[model samples]
Target: MSCSDPRGISLGPRQIADGVYWVGVNDCLKDLFESLWPIPDGVSYNAYAVVGSEGAAIIDGVDEHLTYEYVEKIREVVGDLGRVKYIVINHLEPDHHASTPRLLELAENAVVLVSTVGARILESLYRVPRERIVEVKDGERVSLGDKTLRFVYTPWLHWPETMMTYLEEGGVLFSCDAFGSYGALVRGIFDDEVDLDYYLEEAKRYFSNIVFKYSKNVLEAVDKIEKLGLEIRILAPSHGPVYRKRISEIISLYRDLSLPKPCARATVVYGSMYGRTEEVVQTIERVLERSGVSVDLVDAARTHPSYTLSLVAESAAVVFVFPTYDASVFPPVREVINYLHVKQAGRGRLAAVVNTFSWGPSAKEAVDALSRAGFQILEPVVSTKSLPSPEDRRKIEELAERLSSELRKFGSCA
Candidate 1:
């Protein structure tokens, strides 16, 4: 179906079946990141409508800014606002729920369906009335005319109230943030319609940034989805693009990421005073490369904590190099290490600590911090005062050799 480009509304509709439409709302967030990308690519907040012979149900709504436009589009299809018999809130995050208040006002008689937890959050956060809320549990079915919306409660996929709604009749799953990505849906809204490389990368970034810490819960959610055994023709997410053709491919990607296997790579993160610690980091990188091990060198001072944490989480090993000042580690490196410790991201990963100091004690304090953080130290802490003498250089080389050897062993296990 073709839609005219309106002033404040950009809608693209794909007919999933006889009466179901996959609608695309363009670039919900203009400025996604204040400190990160900090640019506008236009994000897409997608919502689907299952229009049957008798009535209609809107799966999700776009942001608040696009609520009226979404309502108008629904009217165009369903003929009147009152025909929207149900509004299923698959997620309670602001981007998806920002339009809820306005939508509730318009669909006055329509039941707002959500998980019990989701309903609580809505009432607490938005003051939504209890009478209009319809609480659902896992495996509960709500019928809207000929289509049946099946609720699957998936807790901690990202939030406690997060859930997925499956249109059993249409063979489409409205999975709200489970396999979503950042950026805006530029051209097509499905994996098969656009470049898989770009979407997959953005999806990885989104998962890493938002869902990496909840890997255990993500795995459980995937398991729950697998048991449903529905013919999943489409995976409609709240952000970025949808999965129309390659639904299993995207599910497989999430499963792999949720696994406990470490990446066959190493990340060397360091904070340098002048260039001494940086030199050691570079030397370690070269040694690891020579041993046929992939390595990523990150200046802890420059890289964001989120990206660094993701790299550290994926890598088989992590190497920390820092310069000592007043018997303490560099503030930035310390913060990064502390975050890793709190997240327990490096529990089983191989780690090597290297330090440089001019006239004070070596980075023993930093080494202790790492050890306390549960890192399996692969070698003795390597330290140097002033420049590295021949003997000190030899020690550094030995440390590199040990790190590379440990990485090889880790890779073999994987």
Candidate 2:
């Protein structure tokens, strides 16, 4: 509830489990997360304080800017930083570990718990002394008297050192970015407490932008957890709201999003410098809509790549329409394409290209880019010299028919 406490004392160290307290911090000041994606609703750097009879453990840390508020949250829960015997670094990324140095300084006796790869990164990234770090292997268990923390290695879930920390007794999984989202927990911390619909969309956006590339790895990690049969009662991630009431919902969302299943929808991402490209894009959109296909038309000039990538990740097909600029692809369109490539969003997806130019149109570069990015390029790509003529309209119609036919092969829309 409202982590905007100037004094850092009003917001909760909410009890997620019997002893696991949500001590995360909300960042409203930062315009962008990782200096890339916009965070209009802000983002939370979720951390948890797992207290036991003998010792206490802090699972993950907030961003560096929120360190003061974060440490105060820990102090509120444990009274003394010395009580924190284990500082579990589920992920070493700055958003999750930037406050680590200050944390280590305050919790002088606490040993930083990390995976083997995390052990290497601890020194390299944070310069945490080897003596102060305890590298835990996969399936290794650490005890805090009544509570037991089990390490599950979920590599390439965006980072090599990424892992999940499970509190065995509490049945809580401290999944540091794996099941996390982008929205800030200003109202409440639990899924039951906030607007699930809004948060879920933000979660998908987060996954599409940050974790879509490692979708295969995501499924693998999910499989690993399923095989372990650890009854994950609560899912506490490094960002967004914690999941208790809707644990299965988030898991299912992640599974469905990460899995290579095709939805009966198509995303049309286009950038038009002039009216030429927009006119063609609108025609394609109208055709796709008329064919009983759900379509998302995104103007790359207006919409952010984060949103476009998410739509493409779920869609069965993507159509790129843009005007060639200076014998090259449109700058905005190219940026979105590069993102699609990096996020591996085009995998198992069908793509079509439409390029317009006054002099020299370049569709090959865009085709090659999409082809290498894993899209199966549809034939009869519509390229126009200036505007859509009668023949150009026919080609556009044919492209639409091909896309609609391909979409139907995936199954019914609903």
Candidate 3:
């Protein structure tokens, strides 16, 4: 049911339920998300239009560039844009509210609904007028004749003012960024409509890149949903698919990621010069594999931080192999560690540092950084000279064995 547009191309508003329309836009052009994470597969800004008999409410907004398409989608569904009563800002992030100002100008009758914290910052961020803003609290309900929009204040969901909107009648939870992923919707919006496995994997990467640092907050948000007894038949997030058939799987995915029951795999990240560090990396992988441990090797200089973080975040153990450059840890290797520390990864996970240096020591730098990032490092910090001498190779094997044994304790080994 796609149609051509007068101004440009539009996916149009495809209804997911009786009165709810998916009025989102795909952004496949941006190379990097948040100017940090690489999103080669692109991303989507999923907004919604919920129409009741008397009035209509628009849940979330798209990136600033797609303002026209978003507004047209709303107009397509609601006919008279003035009939829109509430422009709900589930999260104050610009991706979800960039078009709020323009939409506000179009839908003159609508007032902006945001959380108490969101209200305070909306004017500053989006130049939205305070008079047009309405502050919503946890469990607050706004009636739109036949449909009722309930707000759950789920703060610290990667943002302090984040909250979710529940359509009380439809069992649809318009979760803002909690279950978001980083893929543009090419086929359809529902979980079963598109490739579920691809989106689910993207969801994991999105969690590691965006929401992992606030894992505790994520757990609290999930618990809040359970305690409130919200019958969430559909999980409509701000990014990626609208989960219907696989709602339970998506919910459990979020819960598990927050608790971070890492999979039975290990990631080996190496930054090598002169092939010395690579030598140790390969040997370690072989040993781990022989010991019944699955291994993923990542070249720190070649792999983007987005993929690296995703791989490292879900693995049971990590082996960092790098050579000392200028008597310090290699720059590329150091960058990965910084991201791990910033994103709050490595917590309760095992890590082993393999260092090769021509001069003074550099293993201590990696050891300290990994420890700060919450990794339980294996003992003796494997250090070697310029190459793998007989003694150095023996130490490398010993380190791999220790790491594999610790991974075995986690019950991941075959």
Query: Tens digit of lDDT per residue, candidate 2, span 5-49?
Result: 343333568888898899988888998888989888789999999
Top TM-score model? 2
Clashes of each: 3, 1, 0
Pairs that collide in candidate 2 are 46-238
**Whole-model Cα lDDT of every candidate shown, in order:** 0.76, 0.87, 0.88
lDDT of 3 by residue, 34-72 (tens): 989877777889999999998999999998998999999
- Given candidate 1, what's the lDDT at residue 2? 13
By the TM-score metric, which is better: model 1 or model 2?
A: 2
Q: List the residue pairs that clash in candidate 3.
A: none
The better candidate by lDDT, 1 or 2, is 2
**What is the per-residue lDDT of model 1 for residues 259-340, given as tens digits with 9 covering 90 to 100?**
7475457888889868978888888888988897788888999987666876776677888888887778878888888877
Misplaced by over 4 Å in model 1 are: 1-10, 33-42, 325-328, 338-347, 359-374, 412-414
